[model samples]
Target: MENLESENTPNPRNPKKPKVVIVMGATGAGKSKLAIDLASYFPIEIINADSMQVYKGLDVLTNKVPLEEQKGVPHHLMGIISPNVEFTSKDFRDSAIQIIDDIISRNRLPVIVGGTNYYIQALVSPFLFDDLIEEMDDCCLKESIGDKELEYKFASGNDNCNVDYQRLKEIDPDAANRIHPNDFRKINQYLGLYARSGLLPSKLFQGQKWGRTDNFKYDCCFVCVDASLHVLDHYVEERVDCMINAGLLHEVYDIYSLNADYTRGLRQAIGVREFEDFLGFYLDKDYNADTERIILSTEDKMSKENLKALLESDNIPHKDLLMESINRLKANTKRLVRRQKRMLNRLQALFGWDLHYVDSTESLLGNSYDSWPRQVVEPSVDLIRSFLHEDNCTVPTKIPNAVASQILDKRDLWTQHVCEPCGNRILRGAYEWEQHKKGRGHRKRMLSLKKSKQYLVDKEAEAVT
Candidate 1:
């Protein structure tokens, strides 16, 4: 699959304005396909919301859309991590906002697509890690050490290191019930935050009310791609088969050779454990083979024989085994899809209800006219009207040229910083800016820019200040 450079197209429908289009669905539900299709119609760039697809060397297993399939639509946040690296929903939320802003700045629609519901919700709602961090600070929270420290502090060298579990039960019973006793990471985060801050993390999280319309400017239209369970199962089965055919086993083998821990998030990804089992079984059969001749046989021959034998074997019956596995997978997939659909419905309902609730509250207080629109909207409209004459609406008058110039300059600077190179402003201190400058393409551009008189003067002036 060839990666194509993304071309920017100005959206004439909403000229000089940006919009966000969020595409959400469960895994194997064709989110990427739909996003690509949407991009074909709109001036949009796709931002991945899937947590698993972000890791490098997990394309086939994670079902990441190939570069060729993206149809030259720019995709962000895919393959951003090594298989061995760690990532979180918080990280995704932070990265996605920046990508969305960048896309908007380029006069393109920001299309967020993936099945990771938490990540999507975090983006649409105010419930973010930054908010959690603020809560932690307000409550005077401190970080907790590893399980060992948690055990020592709580139990004071008791035989049972389950003291952390007991403490969680005492502080936040609901969280304790949901969290497994052995889930050290979650238990530690909960217990540590509570112990240091005197406020339960769960309670702090639960207290924050959401579903306010004033949060975002965009007209959000959530489109759910619905499919029957039978159809979804067929899709998953076909996708799994494709992954296997696309050297998924080989990829798993390569990853296994890296000697990374399987318990970590990357290895714990779907299909990794199953593929690892397949590899182990293959190796064990070769180990138990009787003859040196068999051991010396070609890999193709070994694989063919194994495949034939497995296909022919009556032990555990391949049909029944596959049917059973597929049924289980289908059931789980259906449950997840149903949950996602429910979430979407809830969000839509909440949005509608919130609007009604606000209106009702205003009416009840006898301040129906003193709404947010009165305070913010009328002034903005007046400003816009005053700035633009009826016939000569070429430019806004109230908005100063200097301010407009600065805005345009900042936009240009951001574009240059995010673009190929040479036009970047170093003082912005964006991480992507640094990466852009160090890139090979950017370095070549810098070389060309250095030869230009105006570029050299700008560089010299930048350096002098």
Candidate 2:
């Protein structure tokens, strides 16, 4: 095995934008491992960008790098926030900037590792809506005609979200049509911004140059750790099973609340929401004292085995529900992995992100200790090394003509499609709209509509004859 090391020590404090290395990928792609491996060669700190992992608990469920696995590297923003607080991208950007600055001052390379691409996007791009809003002076924001009345109506409206959305459409059709109608927070934000700035939110957004390479806040070397779909599916299922064995259920049980909101904070994590049904049923069941004791006992392998035996003996239906929730957790996580991969591709193509690819399919599938460093880690370290030492301050990966030809057009990228045939599901961007059209449900809906139309036409012809 080669002694992996960073060839060039970066003087990020000098003229060019302070360099930051971003490791992003789908779940179970080993992004965290790759980032941590950089520590062997460079003085590095890991800044976790995983949305779920930032919450205070659910370590097993979130698959946070166990402290031992982190290789004694300083990791920031992992399990630090209150699980109840809805941490926004703005919060991440603000916190990350401070951390990045601090890391640079200390001359340690900051390696951002996670599956949450939006958080990475917020950090790199300057056109974040919140960031833009913060720059405007209070005096520059004045009340326009009917602004107060519109605000009052929206504030006092009887939960009529449609009315507020309609008002947004009247004022800024482009903005209103770009977002989902049910996204009340976004609708409210658009309305408020328009009222304060005396301009359409869409208009205000113009010339912000979102996703433009030139507008990046830092010299970032983006590395995407990827694997084949089959490999990822297999790996994710195994990971979920491993998490369950590692007391994932116990963590979920710890936070199980009858009225917990799944859309908020840590509850939004895949594992936590899936077990709600089973946990709800288990609590309501009239189990024996021994079974209850086993359930409440420390969640170890023995306790799990005892609980399983007890459930099997009692002929309780809870076992099936438990299995169902576990299956759901696995399925949802796989879907999430696919979505994350798609977003990374979109970032590369539409947003012109120069993502250096690291294929971990072999390492993941074979589970070879040697192949991981040789194939994945060595390439990544080389890329980061070149990025730091090179005059361009970037890894020299050429953008393909296909991606380069993709014009940086936010209007097209943000174009919204409401698939009425598919229950009026809102899909943002042309890529998502295309994907939605290719879905089985959408095709089935389209076929049903066609058959209904043909039936009506035939009946009308018969009546005419």
TM-score versus the correct structure, for each prediction:
0.58, 0.82
List the lowest-lDDT window of 10 residues for candidate 2.
Answer: 1-10
Report the C-alpha lDDT of model 2 over 1-465, residue by residue, as the tens digit.
222133223455655667888999999988988888888887888999999999899999998888988879999999999999989888998999999988877767888998888899899988788755555434545533456646644563538778888888888888987887877768877776766667778766765677667789988888889999889999988988788778787788778876577768999898887988887766533335554432332432233344334335654677788888989998999899889988987787677788888899999988677889888999988888777767453454556645465545432655677898878888877777877788888999999999999999999999999
Q: Which stretches of candidate 2 lie over 4 Å from their true place?
A: 1-14, 143-173, 180-182, 285-316, 367-369, 393-398, 401-406, 409-411, 418-425, 434-465
Residue 364, candidate 1: Cα error in Å is 49
Worst 10 residues of 1 by lDDT: 352-361
lDDT by residue (339-455, candidate 1, tens digit) is 665555444433321110101122123356654344322332332232222212222333344554443333211112225345543322232355456667678887776679687
Model 2 alpha-carbon miss at residue 424, Å: 5.2
Q: What is the C-alpha RMSD of each candidate to the true structure, in Å?
A: 25.4, 5.8
Cα deviation of 283, candidate 2, in Å: 1.1
lDDT of each: 0.55, 0.79
Q: List the residue pairs that clash in candidate 2.
A: none
lDDT of 2 at 312: 52
Residue 464, candidate 2: C-alpha displacement in angstroms: 16
Using TM-score as the measure, the top candidate is 2
